[model samples]
Target: MTARAFPCALGAVLLTLALAGPGRAQTAGPSPTPDHMPKPGMSAPEMADRAAGRFPQPVRVGDLPGRFLLQPEESQPVLGRVTGLVRRDDGGADAIVRLDGVLGLTRLGLQPLAWSGVGARLVAVPVEAVALLGEYVALMGMTPERLRALPTFAPGSATAIPPGETLRIGIVRPFH
Candidate 1:
């Protein structure tokens, strides 16, 4: 597959993840894992606070392992929420996300995010919202069955899907 295939593949996966589920209830909080401690800078209690969504920086991709997928034009620093998830039979899962902010290639230029939600299909960020670079996005290629997953809210929140056994699809760009 070519480098551009990444986005197309991820688009299908996002659709799958967005629509997956047996209509389960959204879990309220995260479960604790004693063995998994916070990153070096954070104290134990500080980690706990981060898990509870009390930290100053809510979305820290630095905390996640492995290289995440993003467009070449996309900036290194990004902020977003993993909104949807679906467990695959093979042990892997799919996920949908929303990037709240990002810096475009040129300092003066700003790009908008394209999002496909349950109600809103694939739509680009409105001109008004483009200044914020807020875009609803989707991502895959991570095991959601593991204890500390990439898109989980806390250690073990009800909505949190654990890391799966494998990545069915390699990381690629979204299908435009």
Candidate 2:
């Protein structure tokens, strides 16, 4: 087609689409399945709530290990690395995170005591308290002080895993 005719044809198509309105334009495709359809009489928020309930992407315990634990709000977001997953008698799990002592010391505004290596310690963080964002496990609403206050997690000890509890996955260290 000629350049002048091309512009005129594009303008006519655009005008047709503009007159169709959003709802009319979107309704051209096949109807959504019942499971995908929004329930009648539901408000926007209600529909959202219903939709959220249908799909729950649970983070598996096996997948927790070796992933970086992030506290995004803090200046140093990379708080630690997940060492393992501890399973409780109640069927719940805790993420064993070996926190970076240097970051902790800096967060608390204290200098490191030793120059050789920062004294990294393990802490058990409830899996429920964390959300998996891509490759990172994000722990929200937890401060450095709060994290420090948590009792250290000692693996292979009676106190670490009560009689019935077990360590489903243990320290996943990267080979140098």
Candidate 3:
């Protein structure tokens, strides 16, 4: 076709699409398999209510190894302040803690399987194995002195300590 005719056809096509948008009612997508999706506002089955006495035993805390301390790298909210800290409470090996929730870093916390030698394997870090980067905490350095100092469990332990003054933060397993 000539250039004039081409332009006219293009304009027609554009007008058709514009008009179709208002005239058509978009259909819903195919329903997913019953087991594959839940109805709106529904909740998935939770672990059985141990307190309800459905079984003999209550949900044991130790059964949930996931409840143990999480490294800053393990949690993604992008910001964590030390919530509760106590050195030598769980013995001389580690500190007990309750890490304050991080900000804007929750999605990052979901990457537990991506943290290792293959697919993010589990890597346990000592309570002292981290530092605060303004709002971002990181595993940067660790020394006995630094551990007992910043990112430490002393008086000000839970207070989102700052990054290294001199110590090079490094990971530490429970044992030496």
Q: How high is each candidate's TM-score?
A: 0.20, 0.47, 0.21
Q: Per-residue lDDT tens digits of candidate 3, residues 14-102?
A: 99998878753656897443321112322212211211122122222222222333233323322223332222434311223323222
Candidate 2: give the clashing pairs.
Answer: none
Pick the winner on lDDT between candidates 2 and 3.
2
Reference-based TM-score, model 3: 0.21
Candidates 1 and 2 compared by lDDT, better number? 2
> lDDT per prediction?
0.31, 0.57, 0.31
Score candidate 1 by TM-score against the native: 0.20
lDDT of 2 by residue, 1-176 (tens): 99889999999999999998776346677865433222334443453354344333644555557888765442436878888777655655667887767546744656544442376678887554455556776654244456656787888632233334433221111111
* 10 residues in a row with least lDDT, candidate 3: 43-52
Runs in model 2 deviating more than 4 A are 1-56, 74-76, 103-118, 158-176
- What are the per-model C-alpha RMSD values against the true structure? 23.5, 12.6, 18.5
lDDT tens digits, residue span 83-175, model 1 = 444343444333433333333222234344333211111111111111111232222211122112223222223233434422222222323
Q: Which of the two candidates, 1 or 2, achieves a greater TM-score against the reference?
A: 2
The order of the candidates by lDDT, greatest first, is: 2, 3, 1
Q: How many backbone clashes are present in model 2?
A: 0
